[model samples]
Target: MTATSASTTSAGPAGVDVAQFADVTASDASLRRFLHGLPGVDQVGCEARAAGLGTRSIKTTAKAQALDLAIRMVDLTTLEGMDTPGKVRALASKAMRPDPADPTCPAAAAVCVYPDMVATAKDALGDSGVHVAAVATAFPSGRAALDIKLADTRDAVEAGADEIDMVIDRGAFLTGRYLQVFEEIVAVREACARPDGTAAHLKVIFETGELQTYDNVRRASWLAMMAGGDFIKTSTGKVQPAATLPVTLVMLEAVRDFRAQTGRMVGVKPAGGIRTAKDAIKYLVMVNEVVGQDWLDPDWFRFGASTLLNDLLMQRTKMTTGRYSGPDYFTLD
Candidate 1:
């Protein structure tokens, strides 16, 4: 198919325009048919491609640029049950000033927190270029009523969340209730619009680990994109197998194809398990080769991590000083 420029107003895959989700979601069979009809994923080929890309050489200046880009693309997160205002304040401070010693470092893309901490994070973040992103819609499990989920999203947006990371109802998705999941995403997307009308971007998390198959991941990626996801994320970081190279490769291909088909570019975030500067640089290499340089920007991509920052900083220090810096040198947070 010849690629057509994507307009929120135009009809999407299976003739379901984002605005017409309510109508399209009226039939369960239609939703299932649409999802299952998507192209199948070649598991071996995908994994092999990702592994090969991981071997690409990124040395000297290019490596430094990739490290900085990865640092800027991080969603510095702390989502524990024991989270407190003080904890969030400290995290937000660290996010704003990732490297107090080196003013050259860029701020993280956002500081992710629970809906209740949005205001605290916003306050702590102040006028810093960093954004406040809140996880909502019963994140991690996404097993809540539509009304409650929408309310959760609204609460965060009202509290000044510039972005919302929401998890899909994995149970519903796995049970073949595609329409229900599709409608839920549509509802959350509607809820993300602020009162003044400028809206927070919505990232739909698939938790690919639970989805259990590459085909499911591919289908979910398309489902979220068609439902108006600004970014299709890999996991919630609460799962055992949060993010991995093959899963990220699949998601990258999904976004690339979605843009090719609809002419709209959505971002991708591979949360969880990305801990080292080497790991991050590998992902950068995948993005650069798989989808080209267009998706390299922080706006178009993000890494949902906290520890990954320190590693990147350490490697960056090593690159600059010609020696590796100990973990003690970086802020603990």
Candidate 2:
């Protein structure tokens, strides 16, 4: 590999040691509470658990709270901003509909929306405690100029996005220009800052699956963290193999190690392709096993899922009320 000079020379500032951040302990009650508070997760995650048991494949790993926490870690929200204006209006209307069993619940994080719809989300969430996140930096491609990217981020924040997700140019990162990616992330992170000087949380999407290997994943994770990624996300869910376990495992370890070295608590977001309760739980178990549990909170973890919420609600209904519900009961529409 191409070991660039700046990455070697820059060790970050005083007490802000990136190397000391990954050592935090895992497993805790706080993480548990944060996850259980979420609205949906039963459709796929719990369905996976039930399906596995029905087939007698494996039923021993059912840690409800852990699984629940995993489900809660999910951002059951969606992307209404990508589609046409008609689609956006339809989705906004769907957001207004109430579920008899599940109701309109707050997701793990705010739904990721286009900048124009930020106000709709803010009004929809209405201080419900769920974050209102927006994608910035020429999302899904990030091929725009830096100034435009920064302007987009500012607009989203002004429109009421609580978190801003910015994409780095994969072209630059892949060609071995680590500094370019680093500078862009730092600039975008700065762009996300609030008026009080405290920046809105920034989740940097590495689109790890697009990268070649685990080593590249590790390297990119390091670069993003070093540049100030509040959360290291896996994909935009726009690409294939969005949130594979192996890739997520690598990211989890990177965060764990980073914490051990820097004392900073960076979060991990395994977005895209995660559809079931079992998948959600596996992610949780992996986090507990690999990162130790301290990273389980919504603050340190989140799943970008449009389908997971239904599965979670179904499971809860089955356990409490003992009946399976239709998908219509859980979906946004």
Pairs that collide in candidate 1 are none
Off by over 4 Å in 2: 1-62, 80-107
Report lDDT per candidate: 0.87, 0.68
- Encode model 1's per-residue lDDT on 180-267: one tens digit a residue: 7877887788888866656789999999889999999988998898788889999999997999989988889989988887678999
- The alpha-carbon deviation from the true structure for residue 88 of candidate 1, after best TM-score superposition, in angstroms, is 1.2
Worst 10 residues of 1 by lDDT: 1-10
lDDT of 1 at 248: 89
- Which predicted model would earn the best TM-score? 1
Best by lDDT: 1
Per-candidate clashes come to 0, 39
Candidate 2 structure quality by residue, lDDT tens digits, 138-239: 888889999999999999988888888888798987876666676788778777767765667889998877886666676677778767788999998898
Once fitted onto the true fold, the runs of candidate 1 whose alpha carbons sit more than 4 angstroms away are: 1-17, 20-26
